[model samples]
Target: MPGVVWIALAIVVTIALVLGLGASRLRTLSRRVGSFSCNARASGQDAWTAGIAQYAVGRIEWWRCWSLSPRPARTWYREQLELVGREPFDDDGPGHYLVRCRYEGLDFELDLAAGDYFGLASWLEAAPPGRRDLVL
Candidate 1:
């Protein structure tokens, strides 16, 4: 009977330790690394645009973001563009956009296509409002 109790305690301790490690790693990754700032002046644009940007700030995190750079930022943006029409740019259609979006608060612009942009928006939502407004 004593052996059984010890075994159970050992199992519990092991689980707790694993959970604690996971939580610790989560905390570490959640830390802000000070990237994703943004500024944009497109080819034909005269006005300078800027915003506070935040995204996962590590090498792996960035590559994950890069994977989602284009597509549709949000369902609304995708739908709205569809309603307006892709126009002479129609060939690219909703997925046609190959944009160099300035990551709000990050110095460099991420060049992305519309489909790729969809996943990026979810990441951007981690930021505060108007903090990720890099478009245009």
Candidate 2:
């Protein structure tokens, strides 16, 4: 009975160590994500850059997601009604957002940043060509 107790203690210690390490990592991830922002206007490229960089080198395990999995990310973005008539997140636009860009296998965005939300759509989606208002 004493031998079983010793083995159980060792297993518990190992699990504790692993969880402690991961918890610390989560903290670092949170910090990085908080301070991350970028100006890649086209497709919100800058934000994606920052998001990936932060998601990488963090205490989280979402780094190098492309290396971890060889599939495209599951894209998610908030939809806004264009009263005049248009969809946001214009799939055909020039910007992209960091919806599931970080933290794989789960949804990452919780609170929506007005800038991140509106800006992403503006930067990424292509406007209708005639809307440019240029005189040839």
Candidate 3:
């Protein structure tokens, strides 16, 4: 029927518009620190999955590349993060290096290009000096 066709077209257009708006809002809210491509393995999982990480304030927001949601899949706070080790790229892969880190009792591996590697390392290491409290 004509009415059914019109309703289907309207639904498709609405879905496209909503996805476009969500992507635009995500881009506007997050600042791109550097190029990132990575795989994450949860504590119990034996396999790795694709993810992307972006730095925001004092946290690293990790998002699943296949997801359309604007929210971060995982957020690693700076205060509870620790760098464990790094592995250099073995071949001509897209990732230049892989940095492993532990945050909030979970471990995550982040892959970065040469340029991004330095930025990520510096961001993690640039903690301010400790402040002492004065006795009243």
Candidate 4:
């Protein structure tokens, strides 16, 4: 093989390896308890970015699917998150719901599967009695 051909092969192999590793890591993370696939969009924006949401005590952490960083890209505290609205999401496909929420006064939306949406609702509703907002 020519020198150029060798270099091209090496580059392609490296790219494939990186993508494979990233995907494998994502699959592993998604299999963990309380983790679900979701897409998020900042309020007023039309783009939805793929990610995984993990429910942690007192908070929800989201990690972008394509990122290699061990830290979550975004975090919403149970105390700060307020559910604004929810509706069907047609942009992505069926069985997806768009949840509009406000955290610390900033609005954002999470696109989730029906099951995941129910899970999120349950998690929020299961907050400690002391943490629940009492309208009285």
Number of the top TM-score candidate: 4
Best-first order by lDDT: 4, 3, 1, 2
Please list the C-alpha lDDT of all candidates, in the order they appear. Answer: 0.37, 0.35, 0.68, 0.86
Question: Tens-digit lDDT track for model 3 on 56-122?
Answer: 8877788776567778788877777777777786443765776677777777666567667777678
* lDDT tens digits, residue span 33-118, model 2: 42333211222233331222222221212232222232212322212112121223433244433232222333233122445545
Q: Is candidate 1 or candidate 4 better by lDDT?
A: 4
Q: What is the lDDT of candidate 3?
A: 0.68
In model 1, what is the error at residue 84, expressed in angstroms? 17
Clashing pairs in 4: none
Q: What TM-score should be assigned to candidate 4? A: 0.86
Model 1 Cα lDDT, one tens digit per residue, 1-136:
9999999999999988877765654444335463332333343454534322334332113312212232212121221111111112233344433344322222223333354445455454444465454233
Q: Where in model 3 is the C-alpha error above 4 Å?
A: 22-39, 43-52, 90-95, 130-136
From the highest TM-score down, the ranking of the candidates is 4, 3, 2, 1
Q: Give candidate 4's error at residue 111 in angstroms.
A: 0.8
Lowest lDDT block of 10, candidate 3: 127-136
Candidate 4 runs further than 4 Å off: 1-3, 134-136
Q: Candidate 2's error at 24, in angstroms?
A: 0.4
